[model samples]
Each structure stands twice: as C-alpha cells, then as structure tokens.
Target: MKNLINYTVVLLLLVFSGCSEDLESVKYDDINPSIFPSSEADVQAIVASAYYPLRGSYGNGIHSTSENGLMFILDATTEILQGPYGVQQEASLHSYKASSTSFTRFYDVFYNKISNMTLSIDRIEKSNVNEQIKKKAIAEVRCARGLLAYELFDLYGPIVVAPLEVLKNPLDEQPLARLSNAEMVSFIENDLKAAAAELKSPAETPYGRFSNGLARMVLIRLYLHEKRWAEVEEQATAIMDMNYYGLEENYAGLWDITAPVSSKEVIWAVPADYAGTSENQWQLMVLPNNFPGRGGYGTIQSSWKFYDSFESTDIRKMALIAEFTGTDGVTYNRANPANYMQLGPIPLKIHPDAARTTALTTVDMIIYRYADVLLSRAEALVNKTGTPTQAAIDLVNIVRRRAKISEIELVNYATLAKFNEMILLERSHEYWCENGQYRSDLIRHGKFTEHAIDLNGAASQSEPYKALFPFSLAKISEGKGKFIQNQGYN
Candidate 1:
C-alpha cells in the first residue's frame, strides 16, 4: 500500500532495497551500490536527492530557515539587513576572517552535493531507463548542480568540482584544485545550456521544479556578473519571449500565506509547508520577542538608511515595519527603540502568519521570479547599448507600476553609469531579502566595500580584495598542497 509518487519516500525505498540484512556479508572495499534508474520512477527519486541542496532546511540547503541561508548572509553583509549579534555585525561591518565559521561552511556542504549529482547523472545515463527519462533526469540534476555551482562561485570565486570518472572511484584519495575563473564559468555555462535544452518550459514545468526559464535566468545572472552584456541581453530576452511570466498584480501578495505555488511571476520557488518539508522562518528572525500577537527572536533588522531611501508612497515598504506596539503595550520606533528594536526597523519581508503556528510558515521561499528578469534585462539593455534606452526604461516601469511607485524617466539615466546605479537601487528594493544578490550587485558596481565603509565607518574593515570571501584555513589544510586560498586571507 506504499505510494511511490512522493520522491522522498522513494529515496528511502531505494536505500533499503540496496541494504543487506547481514552486515558482515557487505564488502568494505566495494563502492556503494548504485540501485537507481532501472525505472522512470527511480530516476525521479535519484534527481530528488539532487534537489535537496536547494531546500529550505538548516545547513543542508541554500534557502535555509536560519542564519545559514545564503540570502540571509548575503543581505546581512549589504545595507539591506543588520543586527547587533557577532556574526550579523561582523558580516555588516565586513570584519569577518578566513577563520569565520559562517563564511567557511558553504564550500564543503554544496560541493559534495555537486559530486553527488555527477554520480546520479552517470548512473541515470548508464541504466536502461527510457531515453526520454534519462534526458530529463540528467537535465534536472544538471540544473541543480549549475545553480549550486553558481552560488559557490559567487561566494568564493571558483571551487573544486570532481569529474564523474573521479567520482566513480570512492577509494581514491584525490585532492583537487579549484577551477580557474574562465574554467569555472564554462563549467556552469555548459551544464545550464544542456539543462535548458531538455527541461520543460515555464508553463509546462510543475510547481516547484526547475524550468528552462530558470536555467536561462541563472545564466543571465552569471553573464551579468561577468559583464558579458550581449549574452545577458540574449538570455534575458529569451525568457521574456517565453511569454509565460509577468509581474504579480500585488507586490506584497506574492509573499502572502495564501500565495499560490503556481504564480506566473515566480520562476522558481521553494514550496514550503508547516510539516517541515521546507521552511520559511524570516518572520522569526526580524519580529521582536515582545511583538504584539506573534513574537520572534529579535535577531536582525533593516537599516534606517535603507528605510529612508524608499519613496514615501512606495508600496514595497509596507512589508517593512518601522513602528509597532509590542505585547508590553509600548510602541517602538527608530527614534525611541526598545531593547529589541535598537538596530532599525523590522524587515518583515513576508506577511505575518496569523494562523496558530510555530516559527515556520507556509509562505513559499521565492528564489527567482519574473521581476528579476525584467530588471535584469533593463540593466543589460543599458549596459549593452552604453546608454539608457526607452526600451530599458519601460521594463523598469513595469516593475515600478506593480510597486505602485511612479515610473522613472529615461532621460534621467542618460549615461551607462547612471542607469546602472538606478538599476542597482531598484534591484535592492525589489529583491532585498528575497534572493540575496544585492551584495553581488554592489560588488559588480564596485560599490561593495565603499557601501560598507559609508554605512559602518572604520569598523567595516572593508578592503578591495575582500570582495570575494576568504577560504578557511581548515579548507586550505584539507586540500594539502593542491589548493590555493583566496587573496586577502591567510
């Protein structure tokens, strides 16, 4: 009576089917048994494990419920999010070192999953599963690997990615070197290209899975970072031509508890539930312990500088709580902050879950959405043309209209630099705590360290070379002589 429709349950079945009752009969010298891809159903289970790295758990996933979430760390380092805690302040002030545990944790956790995807793809291709099934499975896993690779590359330049043949040998003690920058870019580009060819289109793709549009969106991001203007334009335009995505009518409703997983605006979102399959604990991070109806840990807050930058009528700021009356019957605001509200305003990025509940909410963790595409294309157009164009201005207007803010004028952003500055601000306002790319946006514009110093003063310890974080001493030691640490770190 067991159902195989759920891939997580099938993963358990796959594991147990390969296990032996008598442990002594198993050979230690043998590689772990590959018991997958004999059927189309098995391929689904195999790829499901690849999706685990993208979940909203703690350390195991990128969109984690805690401070370990990549977006949380990325935004905390920028002007978007801040707090008085050691790690949060260290991130905000740019005082973290190679020894900092938070910056060091990502490489090992995600690189191993990339290796697992390599093994899964190898197995799926070798098995007798339908050719169509094998193609889709490999594409899904590759998209996952490509996305994970992009995240690690963004954080730490290049990373050690073992080949399938090397992954096939479990007994070998190989210490691999990180790929060169060009090599790393090509590696990610190839995976995404292959995946885009085989994955379903946005309308055809199921609720939480990767679509061809998502693959192209990640490619656009990579191209943007590398300043490959033409390529960025090409990819962003391709997603737009799909005609399947748009701006959600309500900017804040996208994060509402009743938000649909199938929203046309969302390209890729982590389908979260209260059952702990995937979690969203942002409310718990920003809401104060004495918040009226629902209290939280009072861990972090949005900066006043960021709050003041928004136009008074901007609807996006509705999600940010500048004042609130606590359960203690005392109102807290920026001028007279209580113990919990000292840093700034609460960045309640998502709506408060009114239903009786724990810290976790059912609101989906939106990783990539169409608003990003529209804004990214606008940046690309201006950068590609070397001047602001009306075409680009219209794209920005689409997102602005949804924000209920007035449209910006094309003439206002005449030069390339001026247009990019506006695009960066719009991107920050649109994606602040959602995707965490604001740090990269700042770094891309050469404003990351400057912004840190401008906000935090001398305590920032902001350095030019510190743009890419340092590789931990432990990671360097583990690589033996083959690994080279990032610059500006021991």
Candidate 2:
C-alpha cells in the first residue's frame, strides 16, 4: 500500500501541474478532463489528491502525530497532554482564543479540501470509466470528504460547506453560510453512509486507504457525539458483524516499529516510513533533549495525574516514561526535577525508534482500532439503557482485561451517571495519545471544562461555552457579519 501511495503521488503531480498554462490548448500529455482520469490509475490519482492532506506532514495532515496535526491539537486540550508552549499551554488550559492558529488552522486546511473532494467525486461520477470502478472510486473520495468534514465539525461546530454547484462555479461571488446543525449532521452522515455501502472490507482494502469499517467507525463517532446511542450501537455492531477484526493479544505491539499491517485489532492506520509522505515523529516530539540512548526536543508530556490514574499493573502505562537517564549521567525523575519532568511524565505513547538517526520513524499512526469499537459499543449500550447493563460491563471488561487491570463489577456502577464516569475514564486511559477523540468524549459528557478546572484550579480558562471552539476572526470577517463567533468568544 505504501508503494502504491508513492505511485499515486507521482501520478497526481504529473496530472496536475500548477505551472501549466493554456488549459484548452495544452499538449496531449497535459491535464485535460478528457485526457486525465482516463484509466483506473488516473482515477486513483484523482482520489489520492483528496487523501494527501491526511498524510503526517506538519500543518497538512489531520492524522499527523506532530504538534500541528489534529491529534496533538485536540489531545492537548484534554488531560492526556500537557506542555508549557504557546498553543500547547493554551489548549491544555482551555485558554485558546479565536485567533489561536493551532485551533483555526484546521479549518483553513480541511474546509477547502472538502470542496476539492466534492469536485473530484463529481468528475469521477461523470467519467466514462467502468461503472464498478467509478462506484468504488467515488466512494473513496466521499469517505475522505466525510472523514475530513467530521473532523472539522468535531473541532468547530457546523462548518461552512459550499454546495457542489457553488463549487463548480468557483468564480461566482456566492458567500455560503455555515450549515445548520441538522443539515451538517445529515450531510456528513449521508456521505459516510454512501461510502460505507461501496467501500471494501478491511481485509480487502489497501492499507491506509478508507475501508467500510473505517467509514462505519466514523459514523459511530458521529453518533456518539450527537448522543445518538442507538445509531452508535448499530454502527459498532455492523463492524463487529464483519467478523474481520478483533483485539490484539499484546497492547504495546500495536505501535511496534514494524507494525503488523494485518493486525485485526487495527481498523485504520496511516502507513508511515522514515522517508515517506506520512511521517511519525512522536518520539522526537516527546523524548527529553538529552535522553540516554536517543535525542528529542522534549515538547509535550502527559500529566502525572493521568499517569497515576492508571493502575500500576496496567500494561498500557508502559508507554508513559516517568524516568530516564540523561547523557550527563543524571537520572531524571519526578523526585529529581528536570525540564522534562517538570510538566509531567513523557507521554511516549509510540515506542522510541532506537535505530532512528532523525526525528521520523516508521511507526504507523493508528487512527481507529477494534478496541475503540468495543468501548464505543459499551458506552452506547449504557447510554441507551440509561443504566449499567451487564452486557456493557462485559464489553468494558474486555478492554480492561487487555490493559491488565481488574474488571469493574456492575454493582460498582449501578447508576447511569456512575457508569458514564467509569466509561469516560476507561476511554481516556485506553486511548490517550492515539486520535484525540478523548477530548470529544470529555466534552460529550460535559466534563471537558470541569476536568480542567478540577485539575488546574484558577489557571484553567475552561468555560461551559468552550465546548465548541471559536471560529477564526478572519473567517468571521469573510462572512461579513453573517457568521457569528461561538458564544463567549469576542
């Protein structure tokens, strides 16, 4: 799949050269609708362009494990991450403003891609290609569009989505309004549902490409966000019925350098390499600058509170580093305060690439996995029943058992509120640095601001209105007073 990605990238470049002029009178090899997307590979190149922004490049991909990526930006706003830098500190304390580029950049990057994907899908559907190929190709683009839309919507509510007709007429000066909550939900839901119907199973899909399971997983997340318990249950169960996925026996092996591409546990992961379009530089971002065997800038850390939340026997905590020997022959720990230890334990969720000579590593960036499917179903079941169900507890226990922790008896969480609390904590521990959905989980449960205030006291700028991030001032200005900033922000 990685090699196929490289080929598609080269094809994309060859097909769409920005330097070209005279589109109508271009050479035979030049990109003309009649000349390009003329074959299956051409259709792939068109679809690949939509997938480009998902690569692990800083300020480019939503899946990037780097600070600029959606994972870091979203996770920084939760208990899983803490740092003393500009955006990191702001996100950690819920002090971000509309102008904070870290939060606003996603809108600028992905909103345009939605339009591009829409255009790509339209072209693929109108092409004279094989109907079956067109169906799958169009489905791929829709899945990418839906995934990107859901991501942006999760960060900021109800994004401004131009209609396909409006997109086709790019020169028109039609200013579109942000979709209503219902419209946005329906729009994203429709795209994902369509994609899921046509997309292949995980076993049939090329690694890193969207699969039916991935599309359904996004639906599950969307359903969870909307508190649509029944839909979440249905979507999760659908993935389970596929019977192609399950939990990996070893939790830590999920992120091994030579990650198991066929690991049934992984529903979707970005195929990465030291030298590839997708880069995984997590170790460089979190490792202390002077660590014994390796080197890193030591940027982000997980709070000691979060680390302490895990049971001592939890195998998941093995990834969080609390102590390390510096090159100066001094061991840095919480007791012996150091620059890195001051914030908290290093959230080295991804294993350190010991053989790496630079920041990049080949660890595949996991986006969604089967464990999430289990937890989502458990949470949805409890929410749907409005009480702790034995089945829900069993599902939660499945994940806990993998974490090497004692199972919580149903008697312990008899109330709906109590079960939700337990499930939220379980999600935080189970999915800390993976995809940053934990922030959404916290917000959905109305604990986002509460947890910040509880942990940081007066320092926390968290407010109930901060449940949704603010739109950029520029976006508002572009709206010419039509777009209202999120409540509470100026």
Candidate 3:
C-alpha cells in the first residue's frame, strides 16, 4: 500500500505532465462528469477504456506476475517442482516487494489504473452516458477493482480491510485489524456479487465486459477460497452450464496462438494486437535463440523438477516443452526438466503468432477458464469431505484425461491430508503458468511459506497470512493510516 501511495503520486505527476496519447484519440477530456456517452461512439470508447491498464501494465509492459511468481515459490516448497520460480540463478525475488522498485512500479500501476476507473465513473455519473454502456463500464471497473484488491490481499496480508480509494500504513506499530479468512472471503464475494448483478449477461458482451460467466468464475474462486464446498460446486457448475465455455477439444491446442479466437475455453483473456496493442512479450519466459519461431528473453525457464513431475503417460509433459536441439540454427543446452528447467522447457501455455501479422491473431491472454473452475470445485469438494467422491475424481481425471492420460483411475483415500495434496497437484499441473494465478492456490493450501525461500534461503519462519502487501509508506505519510499492516512484516 505504501508503494501504491508513492506510485500514485508519481503517476499523478505523469498524468499532469502529459497524458496518454491514446487518450487524446479518444477525446478523453470530453468524458466529463457533465457530458459523457452522448452517442454510440462515446459509449464504445468507454468500453475500450475498460480494456486499458490490463494490456498497458506498468514496468515497461513487463508483468512480474508477483502473484504467479510467488505461487511458483510456494509450489516448489511442496515438491511440486524444485526450480520453476526462483530456482534459476537470476530469478531476482526480494524479501519485501516494498524494498524493490519493480514492486513499487506495479503498485503505482494499480493506482493509475484506478484513477482511470474513477474518471470513467465520474464521467458516466455526471454525463448523459449510455445506460447500456454505463452498466458495462461500471461493472467492468468494479470487477477489475475487486480483482486488484483481491490480488493485493493475495500478496500482502489482509491487515487493512478498507477500500482501495483509501490507503493504509505499513510502518504503523499498532496491532493490526486484519480480516479473518472468512471475512476476507466475504469482502471478495460482496464485490463479485455487485459486479455480477450490475454487469451484462454473457450474451451482452462477447468478451466485451464483465459477463455472467466472468462473475461465475469470480464467485467460484471466492467460494473455493472460503472453503464453501456447495457454493464452489454451484458456481463451477454454473459456468459449465454456459454454452460459451468449456475445455477446448484439443488440450495442446488450447494454448495455440489462435486458440483464444478458436476456442471458448478461455473465460477471461487479455486481448492483444501485438503491434497496435501492448506487446504479448511474456514469451520471455522461454524465447531462446534464432531457430525458435517465437520471440522473448526466456527468463522464467522451466525446471527439471516440473518436468519430472509429469507421469510418463501425460501428454502435457511433451506439450509443455521441446527437447530437440536446433544445432543447425541455434543451440540450447540440455537441462533437466525437473530441477534444472533452465529455460530448457519453455512455457507452452501461450504460443506466439508465426505470421506476426494481424491484430486478431495475437489474442489477449485468458485469465479464467473452465478447467480452473473444475479444479477449484475439486479442491472445495475434497476439503469438505475427506474422501473425494466419483464426481471429484472425475473432475481431476477429466483434466488428466485431456492431457492424454485417459486411463487415470482415481485411487486411495490415504488421508484427508493426502487428498488435499492431490487437489493441489491437479492445480499445479492444470493451471501452472496458464493463468498466472496459481500462487494464491499455494497460499490457500498453506504450502506457500512451507516452500518460500527467504533472504537467508531458508523456508519462512513466520506463520502464513493472507500474503497481502502492507500500505505504502507514502500513503501513511499522506495520512492514510486508518488501516494498518500485517503482523510480521511492515
């Protein structure tokens, strides 16, 4: 939160100094409290603004996926994989993101985005904004805002239970008023419900705004986190009930560059134009050398442990990597798939367009999907009942089956603990780098700290909390300390 306060100031300065040229094209100033959405074109522009921030994310368009990366660390602790996150020599993870400039930059990015949202809301509320358009924009903003707050909670602990417009202090020495797990879940649920109610139906937005499907996805997430088994099942089942979403017929093709347009598997996606849009540059995860058809610096390389986790029958193992050495064109050293995922096995979750051609091809990323919904339900069911029923088994097996391990027969009740482990395993494999949201899953399973590598390179010594970031020091200085930081770290 301190970082956000600081960044908010910097962002305000930037906004004051010069505005996004893109906004100029939209006649942004025309979007006033007194006169917005007077016409269809204006409404469309407001809808377009909804897609902002997501693609134009901060840090020079580099998304650290602090949530995703942190989750990777958590998964590593569970023997999920030894080195996928920071196992490499250069995966610069810091003890306190508050200490890192990158973390600060992301914090600022969030506020800048919220600022834009505020503007949108102000314009719509003050002007003759299109009713339909206003509904869409408001729903999208609330959903996006809720998502950001939820994400912050995922990172820092939920010590501060106030809204985003307000700020908190990390340095405050007083005992914190943190939200309990159930309370935190309630917060997320209320926001999602508001979004779900006000947002358009699925047919209202063909991925244009926050739709019923998206709300269902968020609800499923909330229910899963709250350990509300029946609710999780209902939400997941609701999504599956929709005709617009499901697992793509081809599992490997699900990540194909054209898959976003080709399949409905994607529940939420960050659409891209590659040239016209913010670069889908995450290829840096495994963009090796010349012989490769893709482009990226290959930073978040795969680990040998991750590779070894795949059963021999798992086709996802093969889909996740390419082993052939392009000796004639480029060379990459052979790295172990498990502990030594040294950029050896690239993330197959997203494939770049071979043509590098049109805007439509470099589709936006998928943030939510049907598979995740099922896995979340599987988690909830297992948590509620020690033994996973056939339905739970089917949920787990269906994903594995899609990965070409069709004969996977669910077995063993060994213990409730063992079953939870299995649910997490399903998440690790099914989600992995796909959604960049797996870290929360690890935290929820209480495995995040068990596997965390602190500054001393030892597992964390503190009790695991919500992992929410504390208020930025800047916020505290600005008198935003109605809130407080989590227990351990400031």
- Model 2 scores what on Cα lDDT? 0.81
Clashes of 1: 0
**TM-score against native, each model:** 0.93, 0.93, 0.76
Model 1, span 373-429: residue lDDT tens = 889888888888798999999999999998889999978988888888889899989
Comparing candidate 1 with candidate 3, which one achieves the higher lDDT?
Answer: 1
For residues 1-490, could you state the per-residue lDDT of candidate 2 as single tens digits?
Answer: 1111112222221111111221111112335554566777667677767777776776476788887887887888887898878778888889988888777888876788787777678778878889998998889889988999999899889988878777656566555688898999999999999999999888887567788999999999999989999999999999999999999988999988876677898888776765545778798888887986787888888888888898999999988888888899898888985788887798887778788877788888888999999999999998997988999999999999999999999999999999999999999998989889999999999999888887778999999888788888888887876677778889
Q: Residue 177 of candidate 1: its Cα lDDT?
A: 92
Task: Supply the TM-score for candidate 1.
Answer: 0.93
The candidate that wins on lDDT is 2
Q: Lowest-scoring 10 consecutive residues by lDDT in candidate 1? A: 1-10
The lDDT of model 3 is: 0.53
**Alpha carbon lDDT of each predicted model:** 0.80, 0.81, 0.53
Measured with C-alpha atoms, the lDDT of residue 490 in candidate 2 is 90
Clash pairs, model 2 backbone: none
Positional deviation of residue 382's Cα in model 3 after best superposition, in angstroms: 2.5
The TM-score that candidate 2 achieves is 0.93
